[model samples]
Target chain A: MTTTLTASKEQSCQTLLASGHTACTGCGEALAAKLVLGAAGSNVIVTDATGCLEVFTTRFPQSSWEVPFIHSLFENSAAVASGIEAALKSLGRQNEAKVIAQGGDGGTADIGLQALSGMLERGHDILYVCYDNEAYMNTGVQRSGLTPFDCMTTTSPYGEFSWGNKHNKKDMPGIAAAHNIPYVATASVSFPKDIENKVKKALSITGPKYLQIHSPCPLGWRSNPQLTITVARLAVQTGLYPIFEMENGKITKVRKVSTPKTPVEEYLKIQGRFAHLFKSPDGNEEIRKIQEIADRNIEKYGLA
Target chain B: MRLDLGAIAKAGTSKANQTCGWRNFKPIFHQEKCVGCGLCKIYCPEGCVTMVEKKKYTVDYTYCKGCGICAEECSSSDIEMVVEEK
Candidate 1:
């Protein structure tokens, strides 16, 4: 069946998330948004939380969204999306459009977690996408629940007394899976096709779905903007971020690391956020710990 | 460019805002080397890269911020990032 649902290359260029927004050059979140929206197609309503995507895409006089879009409080996008879905069902238009709730890591893993959990438990037909850049980038780079250990943020500055964020990144996808959502997946901006396919698959399911996308932030991570895709690719290649899909609380697919696996240092050294980790002996020890984290993920997920 | 206070602007009106001035490097596409893989178009953050007949690609510089993502992501090295002439 030739459903125009699949995102062809030409169709992807004219997606619901149009070009010419004020997102920073080479913004991974912007790219991920485009890919996700393109895959979801025009027949969708989007609910955006207060974050970089919302701020840059909907700047008063200009909007990048072409579909029905709504902005809610940072902590209420999932709730807002549930209401939209319920209204669609009430109007007997439940099949007319899909509802998508999107936000950054801060909104999804921290501020909005309660609302998201409520929506999932209620079994709403909504898709919640968390663009995890690992920090609260729009609010001037604050440390977030999803922030990786030893990563520097404005709030987790590296200095004599501290070593960046002292906590491990929150396992958001695991949390979502534990809720027994119909579908849950982890993706990266580096793999556009993978991201698109995952979104399409999530939308095909009938109940609550969650997608956590690893979107790189050049400004917050202090990496060159041109290397956005490269950075995202290295993240998965290094095993720091495993790309996988779960269905009915079971692992269904895994993107394995090919031979000659990339080392964690290769991924960490590119971004200035981890630059301090390469400077001192203590920093080297931290790098070792970070590698151990990646090694554990590799072993657990069988990524190799 | 007059926008009423607290009103959401029309979709895609940012096209009126010229961002080419922000570019320090411009991506030049070589049609001969392009294999029509469309990876450049896929990875372009601005979504300004247009595919001609599914084979040739052209980038709209009007809004291209010279991020060089297309050039960096082009698998065949068909797209070159050149310093913009001031």
Candidate 2:
């Protein structure tokens, strides 16, 4: 499909997710979407759930998707993808196009979990990717099941009445692995190459595969737009977000923290959502608890 | 009203939307300081940066939202973010 080269970086673009989306400046999910589809190539059908990615990219007529993409609802992307897979197999054209079902944290961890479970149980040949930006970002920053402990959201606003989202982030990778899927992986948007490689790896495997990608939200997370990659990198280095792969319920590989394990404060201080945790003695205790969570993750994942 | 088509948008591309007006600061690429590492192209969220010639890169201002990620992630600090003028 190479034509006269365009000056707008459109022809040189190696991705199926096109540019000029309405995603906030320095949107990590948009970047990750490009990386994922770039690796998966054009011969694929994508079923997306309602989220920032779907909303911004497919704004009806002014679309950014260069491939066949569908957004049925907020909680049925997996079911829709399963139908697509079955349809392809029935038509004897399963080999031609790969099916990808994707959603945000709310759709994946909370709203769409049942459909996802059914898709996994049925063993559909589709990749289910969760872009966990830690909240219901598209519909205003509300706390989702995957929202980290003490992270501020509209529903879990920090105050005397509450410490933002008292519940810890749900173990979605573990849940996906429990389904005995062929492959499950956790990725961050900072590591674009790793994400692309993991998308390729998941597509190569048969049976249901799960990829939970942690992308940053500049507006929701109250972080600087320019520091999107930096914030994601710090999340990994702090051991708060573990990057790993699971094969049939077994942890195969993990991204280890470097020599100087980055302090959690380096990550916390950059985002305004976590700014409340630095205010008082009570906040220090909360900060310590958050650090303990990071420490535990580092030890649990053998990141050191 | 009853219709045969099941709600589908006409064929379109987001390229129709010129997001350049959203820019608060624009990145000015300095060719002399560039080391040709291509990190800017890799990290640009909008996918607006491209290599016009070997080791020389240019950004598509038509679609660039001016997030300054290219400038921030630049290895040699070749891309500098300056306040957008009008």
| Residue-by-residue lDDT tens digits, candidate 2, A140-234 | 99999999999999999999877788999999998988998999999998777778779889999999999999899999999999999889989
- The lDDT per prediction is 0.88, 0.87
DockQ of each: 0.50, 0.49
Colliding pairs, model 2? none
How well is each residue in B3-86 modelled by candidate 1, as lDDT tens digits? 664455687666676778889999999887877778877888888888876568999998899998888877678888899998
Which residue window of length 10 is worst by lDDT in model 1 chain B? B3-12
Where does the lowest 10-residue lDDT sum fall in candidate 1 chain A? A1-10
Q: Give the poorly placed runs of model 1, Cα more than 4 Å off.
A: A1-9, B1-6
Q: With candidate 1 superimposed using the best TM-score fit, by how many Å does residue A253's alpha carbon deviate from the native?
A: 0.4
* Candidate 1 per-residue lDDT over residues A141-247, each given as its tens digit: 99999999899999999999888999999999999998888899999998888888899899999999999999999999999999998899888988899999999
